[model samples]
Each structure stands twice: as C-alpha cells, then as structure tokens.
Target: MNRQAQAVVLLLLGGAVIRACFTDLYLNYVKEGLRPFLIAAGVLLVAAAVMTLWYELRPVPRAAATGDGPGQPEARAGGHDDHDHHDHHDDHDHHDHHDGHGHHEPRVGWLLILPVLGLLLVAPPALGSYAAGQAGTALASQQQPSDYPPLPEGDPVRVSVLDYASRALFDKGASIGDRRVQVTGFITAGPDGQPILARMVLSCCAADGRPVKLGMTGNAPAGLADDTWVEVTGRYSDRIGRDAVNDAEIPYLDVESWRQVPAPKQPYE
Candidate 1:
C-alpha cells in the first residue's frame, strides 16, 4: 500500500482500538486487565499514523533552493562531463521503469480495511451459545478432586458459573451441600436439547476462551433460545452428562428457579 493508504488504515485501526477500550466492548474480546495496554497501543498507533501522514503531505523544498533547478545545470570541473551525461541517462531510464510499474504494494494489504470497518461499524457480540456448542465443556482438565471453601452466607448465594461448576465437579459438591446458589450465564442447548447454563472463561482473550457448562435439570425452564442470558437459582446435583462435541463431563444443576436477565457488562469469567 502507498504511505497515504497505510496511514489511513492505521488511523482507523487505532480509532477502533481506542473506542473498544473506552467502552465495555473490549470486555467481549479480552480480559479487563489488558485495557490499559490496549489503550496505550492504540494511542501509539494513532500517533504513528499522524506522523506518517504529516511526513507524506509535507511540502517539498524547491529544486532551485537545492541547486538542482532545470535552469541551473551543475558546473562540471575537469573531464567529468561525459560521465555525468552517462549517469543522467541511466537515471532517466530508471525513472521510466519506476513510473511504468508504479509502486508494487501487495493487494492483500487492502483486506485489512474489512476488519477495521467491522470493528468501527459493527463490533461483534461476545462468544455465546454457538461457540459453547462447538467446543466441549472446559471442566475436564479442572476435574481433579480438590478441597473447596464453604458457600458464602446467603440462602441463595450468588456464585459464578465457573465457581459452581468447579465445586460441583472437582470438589464433589462437598462445599455446596444443600445450599441454593444463584448463577448467571447465557444458555446453550445440550446434546439432548436441554438448557445448559454456561459461561466462557478467558485466560487472556476470546480466542482462547473455554466454556464452563452446567447441565440444567429439575424445574429448569424450557424452550429458551441459545444465548439468552439468565439468572438461575439451583442446588448442586450428582447428575452429569457428556458434551456432544468432545464428550467432556458436564455436571448437572437441580435448578430451583430461573429468570431472563440482561447480559452482563463483562461476558467472560
């Protein structure tokens, strides 16, 4: 790409990054901790773009001032005139070739504008039920048995889906006991078309996100479409099922009640 086109791409990309970081949009793609770094990088890119544009658009010095004007030929001393003439002819030939082909920038460079436009115009929603359905439950690696702390003091203690799944699967529901816990997450249909409460956990960003799923049973709501956010109050259960995609274990939850809710500001855990 020409320097001008490159600068425009950089400007758009930087603006997109800054916009994402300034709003809750960044949470859809990355961990909250990376916000500052993203903002800094965006600012740097914008600055670089501005500098590039300035350099490209700046006025060029007149040839007369540099003693290279057409009216002012170089005063050759000694017998170097013949060599200068030959050099000038070679320069003219090189310029003819360069002008004929123009600058050869890869066509692929233009493809970058698509993503920039997507980010600026239509930021994609966070990974939801579709992504969850495509991957196995993320609980397998975390299934190693371990001790868990007791549930917090509340009849319906609010807990994250990840925490509840960890306790139910790895700790064997020892900590959950008979307590009714409230968990919030988007719904993804299980292999049997049952509603499963699931949250995506991001170690860094959405590209590395893994789903933590809890199979819903006992009083669970039905007919809800995928990606519907909900708050579910439930007790732990021993029932488990295998993920259709990878046959990973998905622990069950004996849902007491549930209600539709708005998606959270931060979609990932």
Candidate 2:
C-alpha cells in the first residue's frame, strides 16, 4: 500500500478505538481497567497518522529556489547523458524494465482495513451462549470454604452468577441458606436441553474468558432460546451435576421465577 492508504487505515483504526473507549462497546472485548490505556494508544496512532499525511503532502523545494552554483548545469547535463546511456541499454534488454517510482510495499498491507472497518461499522457482540456451551463451569478450586456474609435484607437479593456458584459449590450452600436471590445471565442449553444460567468470567479479555454455569431446576422456564438474557429468582440447592463436555461440577439453583431482560452493558464478570 502507498503512504496515503496507510494513513487512512491508521486514522480509521484510531477513530474506532477512541469511539469504543467512549462507548460501552469496549466492555464486550476487554476489562474496564484498560480504557485509559486504549484511549492513550488511540491518540498516539491518530497523531502518527496525521504527521505522516502532513509530511507526504508538504510542498517540495525546487532546485532553482536553492540558488545552485554555476557548475550545477554541467552536473545536470552529465546526469542526463548517463540516463540516456542506461535507456539505450534497456531498449534491447527485455528484463530491465522499471516502474520508476521504486516503491514495492506489500499488497497485503491493505488487509489491515478489514478490521478497521469491522470496528468502525459493526463491532462484534460479546461472547454468548455458544461460547459458554463450548466451555465448562469455572470454579476456583483453590479457594477454601469459609463463612460468607449474610445476604442483604431483600426478598430476592441481587447477586452475580459467579458469586452464587462459588458460594454454592465451595461453601457447600451454608452461606446461601434458604434466602431467595436474584441472578442475571444469558441462558445456555445443558446436555439434556434444560436451560442453564451462565456468565463468562474474564481475567483480562474475552479470549481468556470461561463460563460459570448453574443448573436451573424447580419452576425454571423451558424452551428459552440460547443467549437470552434473563433475571432469575431462586434459592440454592444441594443438587450438582457434571458438565457433559468437560465433566466440571455445576451447581444447581431452584428457580422460583424468571423474566426476560435486556443484556447488560458489561456481559462478563
């Protein structure tokens, strides 16, 4: 690609990054902590692209404007003579052709625009049920069981899917007791086609995310499509099952009620 094309690509890419940083879209791919770094990197890329365009478009100085010495005419004449001689030799040599501008940038450089356009025009959605189904429940086995604080005073206290799973599996349901809690996550199908509540856990970005699933029993709704975001009110159960794909232990939630809800701004925990 030419320098102009490179500058355009860089400008689009930088703009896309800045736009994602300002919006909630960046949460789909990465952690909230990386926003400042992403914004700074985008600014640097934009600055570099602007500088490149300015340098390429700037006016060139003429030889006469430089006040060349009298001997310059003779030097120019000799240079033309050498050029004529080379042209004469090339007239008979079929393999001596040149494109004149001399730049040989790889054509593959244009491929960079694909990702730039993707980010600017149609950013990808966050990892959903398909991604969750491919992986097993992620429970921190190294975490020892302990007394967890009592649930806040609410008929159905709001809690994250990961926290509920950890308390149910690691704490052996002691912390959960008989209190009804509300959890929100997308639904994924289990081995027997039952709806499972799941959320992805990301240490850094979506690439390293793994699912934390809870088997929905009791009055849990049926026939909900995968990736349908919902709020479920339920109590912990002693029932546990193994993942069909990886045999990871999945805790159970005895759901009492459920309702479809819009997806959250931050999909991962």
Query: Once model 1 is optimally superposed onto the true structure by TM-score, how far is the C-alpha of residue 224 displaced, in angstroms?
Result: 1.0
Off by over 4 Å in 1: 63-74, 77-99, 143-145
**Alpha carbon lDDT of each predicted model:** 0.89, 0.86
Model 1 weakest 10-residue run by lDDT: 64-73
**C-alpha TM-scores of all predictions:** 0.89, 0.86
Per-residue alpha-carbon lDDT of model 1 for 1-269, expressed as tens digits? 88999999999999999999998799999999999999999999999999999999988887633446577656678766745766887898899778966567888989989999999999999999999988888877764658787888988999999899888888889989999999999988889987888999999999999999989889997888889999999899999888888888888899889999999999999
| Whole-model alpha-carbon lDDT for candidate 1 | 0.89
CA displacement after TM-score superposition, residue 209 of candidate 2 (Å): 1.1
Candidate 1: give its CA RMSD in angstroms.
Answer: 3.6
List where candidate 2 sits over 4 angstroms from the true fold: 64-102, 140-144
Residue-by-residue lDDT tens digits, candidate 2, 1-269: 99988998889889999999999789999999989999999999999899999988988666443434465533355466535655666774544346444456788999989999998888999999999888877774437557777778888899999889988888888988999999999999987888888999999999999999999889997888889999999898999988887887899999999999999989999
Maximum-lDDT candidate: 1
* Candidate maximizing TM-score: 1
Error of 2 at 223 (Å): 1.6
